[model samples]
Target: MSEQSVRRPTQKSRLARYLIPIGSMAAALSLIAIIYLGYDLAKGRISPCEAVFQESSIGLKTKISFLKTEGELEIGREQLAELTERAQMTALNLKTCCTVLDAGRVDPEQFLQCKGSARSYEARLDDIAALVRTAVKEGMSTGSVATTAATAAPTPPAHVEEQIAQEVEAAKAVSRDFNKQVVQVRKEQALETLQATPPQNVTIGAQEREPNSDLLTTNGLSLDTWVTAAIGDGKDSDYFVFTTPKTYRDRIRVELQNRSTTLEPRLRLYDASKASLGDRYNTTTGADLSYDFVAAPDTTYIVRASNYYGESAGVYLLRVTPTKAYDAYEPNDDILTAKPIELGSDLAAGIMDGHDQDHYRVETGDAEAQLLVTLTNSSTSLRPQIRLFDASKASLGEQHNTTGGGDSSYLFKAAPNTAYYIQVRDYYGDAAGTYTLTVNEAQPGG
Candidate 1:
């Protein structure tokens, strides 16, 4: 047959051979281009902001994982749970930031917000790390999980908006030192301005015209005098100052009564240096609170009256007066100042002051097998507890009874001729009343 008639490969088959190889090559090249794009993204070969977002996302994931491991090592299960939760929240916050960045070019305000949020997360992470360290230390020392954790370090202050208005005139009468006297003057002026134009629907009594909102410039309170004032919105507090000389007014009583049924009254005491003095007294709305404290020599004291709820506005009556109330013998609240008691001695005393604890020392005979100590609280509401310590102040026995009565009794044998110390304290730290104590010897097993 001739060549053409013999069917030398058809044109279609000839073309298919070359086209198939070229098509395969083209497909392989396209796959390689796609892979290169993926590689570029994975390597962060992107704009600066996009790279930042990518890095942050990865970093947050790494932190979450790290926190999980650290949490496992923590001794406190609560701490571990808190850390895990915070890590998860941080991961979610990072995602939110990434979404914002992905939308488009980052707006200035939006970027700042993201940055602030990131900083907050970082601060929390630091705090958690510190807490774990502290917990580990405390556990090693006490052989138990710590019930309290130290507070975190302060964070950097945020940027505040700048004032655009022209600056006001400088003060002419004030000295540059800005002492307390100057501060009081400024406060007085502010008070006058506030009183002259009281808030709508609010009234300031003629007797309570001055605003004694600060500890330094508290309104003066004379003994046995009663005064009334109204609390205003948002941190409005009234402070009253009184003198308690060691000789004349050493024992003083302070009373507060809330007149408004909707307002809860709270009171706090401060010393001349503005340091807090005792437990904060608070009562239900319209209830009264009375506090007695033996003041230091020639000292100035402050009484702070305010609404317990921040938003509540109401009126309260306050009185500071000298009372015939018994004072806890001064300098006897600690082991160093313990009142000495002999065998078969009966002593009458009072807790008198809020938070007061009475300490006594007793001498035991070598022949004596045991000592019987009894306490009777005068007030049924006052629950007193007795703690007995050896001469070294190491606690040996304790008796605290509430079901039977507010009284406590303990019988224990001490080391031969041992000097023992007894302590009396209120169970809840707020009870104030008188108590009678007695101690006697008894035979063992009797």
Candidate 2:
């Protein structure tokens, strides 16, 4: 008995004697408390750190996955979705690494041993995954990290194959295949903009002129005045009567009966000595043609035109004029003491108040024959005027203007006794034609 006596409790090891029982009992209670307290913890749901850790884990796995499938056909979009989802799952695990620490559930010192194991194998060394792996490896338990990872896994991103395909198609529409289609489209648009954007619209400051040519030999003394051909090449030795006062102020505008035609014209100037003034013209173009030279007082110029040059033949008008003009005269002639003039009917010369037109009859050379019209002084706003001419449409002078008087006389010494037609027009002017026109032959001074 003495011997058997207590070999008695040969001093049991610490846990076998008292600590084990106490620990086992306490563990059950601890489990319940841990679950409840974990539920109550401020950080039980997620430590944003887990996101970083999850990203790192899945990131390494994804990178490894991509490497494993290298040189394969483009990854089917479906497979890519699966891989991304896995990455998001792993990313969630990292969320708990720090929160467990914050909640005192993890002793950072004890977790340090597992730090390396927790690291995510990301090819990129960004601190995110590296940090989570470090925190987990520091002895962070697998259960702690894994639970958070599972919960934090991002929901699979919505499959967007249709949307992606549409976006791709839209991008390719402008560049089908390998060609850059925008180049041509852009170039064409630029060209159209340039052409349609309207020109600078210069108001013709200094006129253009052509100074020298070896064609015409005549000092423009007079026109050939040929009935031989109303619309043909002009006389080789004839002249024109257009002049330019200063080289800087000369321009000759030309228009063929149609733009499809061309012409070569010559102009020569002469002094009182009948000597050539050393100026001339000769050209061929479908548009306005001009001659330039400093003009002298007693000099005369000319325009000898021909349907010459590379173009079609059409009726064209060639005008001859001096750049500087003479003062204008009013319309005047007395039909007062005279005859029964029918109004509205065509007259030898008078204002046709109805159509707002004017009439003029010219004698051969009397540029002085004119209509003397007197109008009331009024606002100079709309100074509409009308003048009439012969078959050539030479300006006989304004047959109707709002400035002249009621007893206005329209006299024409230009055509002493020729039957002329007058259509007075242009009535919108602020001034009214108060006085009616009186027609009488202008007293002529030979």
Highest lDDT scorer: 1
Cα-lDDT of candidate 1: 0.63
Local error of candidate 1 at residue 260 (angstroms): 17
Q: List, in order, the clash count of every candidate structure.
A: 0, 55
* Cα-based TM-score, every candidate: 0.39, 0.19
Worst 10 residues of 2 by lDDT: 221-230
Q: Model 2, range 1-446, lDDT digits (tens) per residue? A: 68656665565564387888788899999998896576446344655455446445645565636533431122245544543443444333233433434422435552342233234213222222233233333323434565576764222112332333343243233122112222333354457656765422111111211221222332221211211111333422323333343322222332222233444434344543446654333455444444443333343444444444423333433433444321111122211112233323223322223222333332333443543333222233324454544444445565444444322234444453344444343455323232234343334451
Candidate 1 TM-score versus the reference: 0.39
Candidate 1 per-residue C-alpha lDDT over 273-388 given as tens digits, one digit per residue, 9 for 90 to 100: 77998745464766677877776546777788877766667777888877745444545767888888877877888776556778899987766467888998777666778899
C-alpha local distance difference test of each model: 0.63, 0.37
